[model samples]
Target: MKNGIEIMNVEQTFNGKKVLNGINVKIEKGEIFGLLGPSGAGKTTLIKILTGQLKQTEGKAEILGKDARKLTGEDYKKIGIMMDNFGLYERLSCFDNLKLFAKIYEITDDEISGILKEVGLLEAKKALAMNLSKGMRNRLQLARVLMLKPNILFLDEPTSGLDPATVDAIHGLIENERQKGTTIFLTTHNMAEAEKLCDNVALLNEGKIVEYGNPKELCRKYNHQKKIKLHLYDGQNIELEHDKSVAKILNRYFEQGLVETIHSTEPDLELVFMELTGRKLDK
Candidate 1:
């Protein structure tokens, strides 16, 4: 079966300084594949290589089985890209900004309207892009890209600055795309979002893929010191390790009906990433 996007030992360099080092990844058809990393992790460089904006210095990058370098302008009809600070005409209304893109891509108004509704921008269509809130601008950008139902979507930090509600709305739109069989390559530092949305992920460090697997699997693999914390009704708190259940003490509390609350602490994607990279995503 064709991997929607594939890279084999890919490398990128700028001014003789390498940015990506021997990267290898295969994003399956119709799956949301996350590239997780912190700033300066070469995530953007890899995206540029995949989208054919920049050529790799070594190895191969392909979309739909064709070399990235060989992709013609026509090939872009199958791709949608939403990078950070994606431009919108500040002077134009939200609808007008999308209209410009529609005219270039030859997208009909019906599709544009439908996408605006999908991204929850239908009500703000007449508002100037500059007048729209941050969340609204994000929706408008997503709508513009969705005007063409591309087979592959490259989203870079799709929810970086938005509030929780907007983040949820954006992810809902992403899920709809995933359901429609769009292969999404998402690059984000939001580890929780990655774990929640990705079918599989590659944790990228400075230039290399430090880990690759389902997010849950990676987290489980590194959950060596799993712990549980509980507060006792008797005004005492205790921490118990998974491997060493600490049952003798816990059983005493259990028998005495003295447990007030208990919480199990499983390793999350952020902790797992930190374990591999020696730093958190924000840092």
Candidate 2:
């Protein structure tokens, strides 16, 4: 809670329904912290509160020691947010979109082209925003956010609906940003993307954090059993649960020419989600 962005006991209610109940998180500088949750799980609401667009009914959210609810003009200047609903003007060219955001973020022309090229939109600079593909538009949105040269980035579903290639491009850009000392808070339903890019992740269920830790740590914690799978020379597949005996047996099998291929199996994030939350990410 002392470093990066902290949200302590944050709660929110909509009409008579309590959406977020005592939600808390502390994201560190230069770390890609992922908020993993299904749709309608209050991810967007929490993001709104953190960005000062909405007030929490109870508790507090802070960024770099500044109260999230009372963010100053300078605070806005240092944070970049790319949400699902942050619209791009249909009439503007991709370059113009970045140009407008550059003015808003007070960045100079000297840095705009570099940011565009970094996000792979330099080729689409003259294309109308409305004419871009969905993936291209998403990249343009991210490019617009980076125009601020912000220290902290709040991204909601950054790779949603993008093709595998576009997703790779976006992930590379995100890694590049983190390397440059940008703190990223990402909310996504894409568990694979989260596992690949996040340094730490929190599983949010019904607006509360059900679990939080490094992805590998969580996987090890939840996986009560491990299996060793092997392909035999006779084209038969064999599986043995991991144990001291299994290890010895596998070594002997390999030496006896009985093993062709082998792999160890542990529960993945999706399996862990079902074990912990009793539901799939898409559900």
Tens-place lDDT per residue, model 2, 101-121, is 778766777688888888898
Cα lDDT over the full model 1 = 0.88
Model 2: lDDT of residue 279: 85
Off by over 4 Å in 1: 1-3, 231-236, 243-262
Question: What are the models' TM-scores?
Answer: 0.90, 0.95
Candidate 1's residue-wise lDDT over 175-282, tens digit each? 999989999999999999999999999999889999999998888889776787899877888888766557787788789898999977768888988888789987
TM-score of candidate 2 against the unseen true structure: 0.95
Candidate 2 displacement at residue 6 in angstroms: 0.8
Q: What would the C-alpha RMSD of candidate 2 be, to one decimal place?
A: 1.6
lDDT of residue 109 for candidate 1: 81
Give stretches of model 2 more than 4 Å off: 1-3, 257-260
Instruction: After the best TM-score superposition of candidate 1, give how far the Cα of residue 202 lies from its true spot, in angstroms.
Output: 1.2
